[model samples]
Target: MRYEAHLRARALERPQHAALVCAGQRISYAALADIAERFASALVAGAGFGNGERCVLFLDNRAETAAGLFGTLRAGGMFSVINPTTKADKLAYVLNNCEASVLVTQASLLPVARAAAAQAPSVRHVVVVDAAGELAGHEVPWDEFIAAPSILDPASRGIDIDLAMLVYTSGSTGEPKGVMMTHKNIEHAATSITTYLRMSPDDVVLSVLPLAFDYGLYQLLMCVKLGATLVLEKSFAFPQKILPLLESERITGFPLVPTMAALIVQLRNFRPEWAASVKFLTNTAAALPPAHIARLRELFPQARVYSMYGMTESKRCTWLPPEELDRRPDSVGIAIPFTEAWVAGEDGKPLPPGAVGELVVRGGHVMQGYWRNPEATDKALKPGRYPWEKVLHTGDLFRMDADGFLYFVGRKDDIIKSRGEKVSPKEVENVLYALPGVREAAVVGVPDPVLGRALKAILAVEDGASIAPRDVIAHCAARLEDFMVPRLIEFRDALPKTNTGKIRRAALQAEAEGRELPGEDA
Candidate 1:
């Protein structure tokens, strides 16, 4: 089935049904489908978009963002949603990497969008939402862009194996790598995840996660697939504002990460009665501590809390059934439906139960690979047990109980998962190194209850440099995304090094994880 199938079916079957509710406006399925179809027409007639072409959506979580997304798919083109917080350089890099033909953005972000699009020769059109009448030769207003006459041919719809999305993720080497996924892959992941979550058309789910994130994107896709209602919020930063929606919207499904759960734990005025309608509460990114889990149960007494684990590569890996949570709150549960996951040692052999090893997942939900990066693709998608198959080797360490329940140990790589968003230390360090420090720079993830893994930057600057923490923060703020900026900064006279003169990153990581570094009191 196509990704936009639900929008079409819902528009026909439940025309008046509310599909999305965001920012005080409610959009019906029929309205959404019409918008998507109009957008499809616009893509073809206005931008000369073809069946394998790419469209980059750089906007916030709103009805328009949702429409632009399915519209690209409806038009048989691939789409990528960049985080609204992404800087111009990264945005431009993604545009160039995907060779996007169209970019859907807002007038407020035109400065950055224009800057990025100026550098991207592949971009043919910049569709601006809420723009004034004046426009550039290559620019078009949202209203006029969607007004194109329909010229779609149903027979031309592509097959499921065609590329459907390009989700750019943080690379280990200070760059962004696009994760490639086809329609078939997305369908499998959405189906497998929804099957275990017990989602249904009757459910009204509330999502505060960014659409740029796969976790949040699926919430929209699955809701539309089931004809369910999605109440979108910009963020969970203000729990007080979002808490009331649980009752008003009759929200049954609540998806969160460790950071949101931590925020929940900090709410003193939280009333369990406020969430009486909530049926399913899910968490991922980082497993919640047992005490936090216990507290969550008391907070959402009627809701079944599911602690899940996954990444963009697989979309989702494991989901702990709510019934089994009390028994093993620390475990991220078993492999999702229609999938196989096992732990393997360094030698690529299966590890005995209870032995920590890299998690290996074999499933149709596995991403196609990184876009334009075959070397990285080979590293992640290694040969499976069968001759013709390849499996995803999640760079994470986990141990399984004899019963097959998996418990997370730690990451095999240094990609810091902060606030449910992956932050490459190298990427952050690259920005730090360019801050005129005149010396050394390093970044590490420090264990934190709230942020999942708070980013900390350690530096040894020149003797005469007068840079302070605020100055460094300002410099990073001007360059990197907000999530990539280091929250904690410390200066040292010297940095630890190996006998070979290479900086020891692990030493700093261990210190941030609570152990003392060399020359410190043990």
Candidate 2:
């Protein structure tokens, strides 16, 4: 079923319930539904947006972002959300690549939006939110854009198989690829995830991750499907201020990545009682260090912690149940509910337990394909055992335990080759995380004449902690094999990360190779 139908159903059943809360502004189910319907009508009547057209949203985490998303879906158009921090050139690339017909953004970002829209000829209209003065000929203030009479006619123009969203990847290796997801694909994923999390109408979710990241986007989508309240925040920049807001909102569910966890664990004055209302904690993007997992449990003794693994190709692949955290803290756990995950050898045959291979997933949640990139799409989606099926071949390497729990080994390309032996960066990083005063750690291979590729460990230490390079190397030498141990150690104030909080290893590798860093401009 279409996602907007969930909002409509919730509005009919619980009109007065809070659907979204951001910056002290609360929108009720009925109000949000009405605003979305009005916006959809405006897109169709005023802007002449045709069925299956593309509407791109370039806004921060706010109530209007939600409205723009649902409205585009209701109007029978696909929607794509660009990171607000994106520059003009990359933004223009996305607009032209998708051939977007409309662009919605706030006045605060008008300069960049205007510049990008100028280069994208396909963008026929620009809807400006929070405008100050008269708009340009192609621009319309949000109020004027959504002033059309509410109409429900456009919602019936599409079927479940139609495209719903075009989520762009972070593009660490090359140009970003748009992942195409259909309504049925999204619905299945949302249903499976919420079912595993045991979500209900009374649950209040606090989201700090960017909406452009599918991990963060799903939090909003799942809450809407369950008729739960969502509290949106721009970022976790100031955790001290967010603590009180969490308490005041009585947030029950908190979603985070490893970067946020590292920041929280380092807060000197943090206390467990401050966030006692948190009923559950969920983490992905990267595996939370076992130390951080233990610390999080100490801080929120009442909350259950779920360690998950996924990529943009499939919304989610696996999640470790809270009850199993003690037994398999390192494993990403079995396949998420309603999905099947297996480790496949290079020949595409399933590997036995304890063997390392590529992770393959079979489920309806897998994306249709990458937009306008058939070569990459074919590489990712391959023939399954059945003649009619296609399964997603995740490039990540993993090993399955005897009981079927999966442990992540690094990415296939990310594996370090040193001293004629293959080494998993995650293995070395995991050891580094166990060291005292190490806040974050990343391992990459640098060119070496003798060893072929020398292992380098880049780290960020906790504030006021004394950790020298020799100390880190000595610690690794004690726990790791000689070949697996890092040959070089460098400390930085912070590791560069994607908007979703995953470390940009490719960026670090580029710096090591003395090359221009990718994504620095965009």
Candidate 3:
């Protein structure tokens, strides 16, 4: 089924049910549906947007963000949501790349959005939400654009196979690539994930992750499919303030990344009961250390912690069941429901257990390909078992245990070779996380005349804790082999992270090699 149909069904069934809660504002299902339909009519009838046209949303986590998403789908158009913090240049790149016809943003972000929109000549309309005054001839205020009353449901002109969303990845190596997903792909992913998570209409989810990230976007999709209430937050920058919303809203599910997990465990005055209402916690973007998992369980005694692994190419790959957390805390679990996952060697053949190789996935939810980039698409999608099918070749490295549990080794490009020996950064970072006072850690390979490449350990210490470079070296020396130990150690107030919260290893390597880094706001 198409995603917009889910909202329509929910609106008819439970018109007064709370569909979205953001910054003390509650929007009912009927209200959200009405607004989305109105905006969809405006896009087609007023703004002259054709079917399958692209609309880029550059707004924060507000109620209007949800409206814009469903409205685009309802209008039979594809949508791409950009990170609100993105600068003009990168924003222009995405706008031009997708050749978006409409740009939807808030009045507060007009300075950057307007600048980027000027460079993207294909943008025919700029709809400013919460605008204070009359807009330019080409731009229209959101309320004024959707003011006309029209049919709630337009004639169906597109099918499930049509493109639905474009999720742009953070470009650490070069320009960002937009991952293409269809309505069927989204439906399958949401169905499989919600099935495993056991979501229902009574579920209340709390999401602080950005909508630009696929992992964060699915939170809204899954909750809407189940007719659940979603509580949106701008960010986890201030955890103390978010803790209260978790309690008052009685949030049943909370999604997090490793960075947020580290911050939560380090909070000095944290109270266990602050998260007592949370029934389950889900994690992705990066694996959580076993220690953090233990600490989370201690804090939310009644909640179940699910450790998951996924990327932008596919919505998700694997998820470790909460019951097996103690047995294989390091593993990212098995393939998600209805999905097939396996490790393949360089020959493209499946590898035996305990052998490290690239992870391959086959499922309905795998992305179609990168938008307008066939070279990158060919590299990522390869021939499947059948002649008509292509499977996703995830660049992530993994190894399966005897019981078929998958452990993330590192990315294919993230491996470090020193003294003619290959080293997995994840392996070393896991040991660093075990050390006292080490809040966050990353391992990168630095060029060396003698060793070819030497390992470097970069870390961030816990709040109010002190650990010298020698102490970190000494700690690694005891836990790692001679070649695996870092030749250099550096401490930073914070590690460079992608917009989605993954460590920017390439940026760190560029800094070590004295190279200018690309714009990371994308």
Instruction: Please report the candidate that would top TM-score against the real structure.
Output: 1
Q: Which ten residues in a row have the lowest lDDT in candidate 2?
A: 414-423
Model 3: per-residue Cα lDDT over 303-395, one tens digit each: 889988887778889999999999998889999999999999986678999999999999998999999999888988999878999999988
Deviation from native of the Cα of residue 287 in model 1, angstroms: 1.2
lDDT to native, each model: 0.89, 0.86, 0.85
Candidate 1 RMSD to the real structure: 2.4
Candidate 1 TM-score to native: 0.97
* Regions of candidate 3 where Cα sits further than 4 Å from its true position: 152-154, 171-173, 414-522
TM-score of each: 0.97, 0.81, 0.81
Angstrom error of the Cα, residue 444, model 3: value is 5.9
Give the lDDT ranking, best first: 1, 2, 3
- Candidate 2 Cα deviation (angstroms), residue 132: 1.4
Number of the top lDDT candidate: 1
Once model 2 is optimally superposed onto the true structure by TM-score, how far is the C-alpha of residue 321 displaced, in angstroms? Answer: 1.0
Candidate 2: lDDT over CA atoms?
0.86
Task: Put down candidate 1 lDDT per residue, 273-309, tens digits, no spaces.
Answer: 6789998899888888888888888888888888899
Backbone clashes in model 3, listed as residue pairs: none
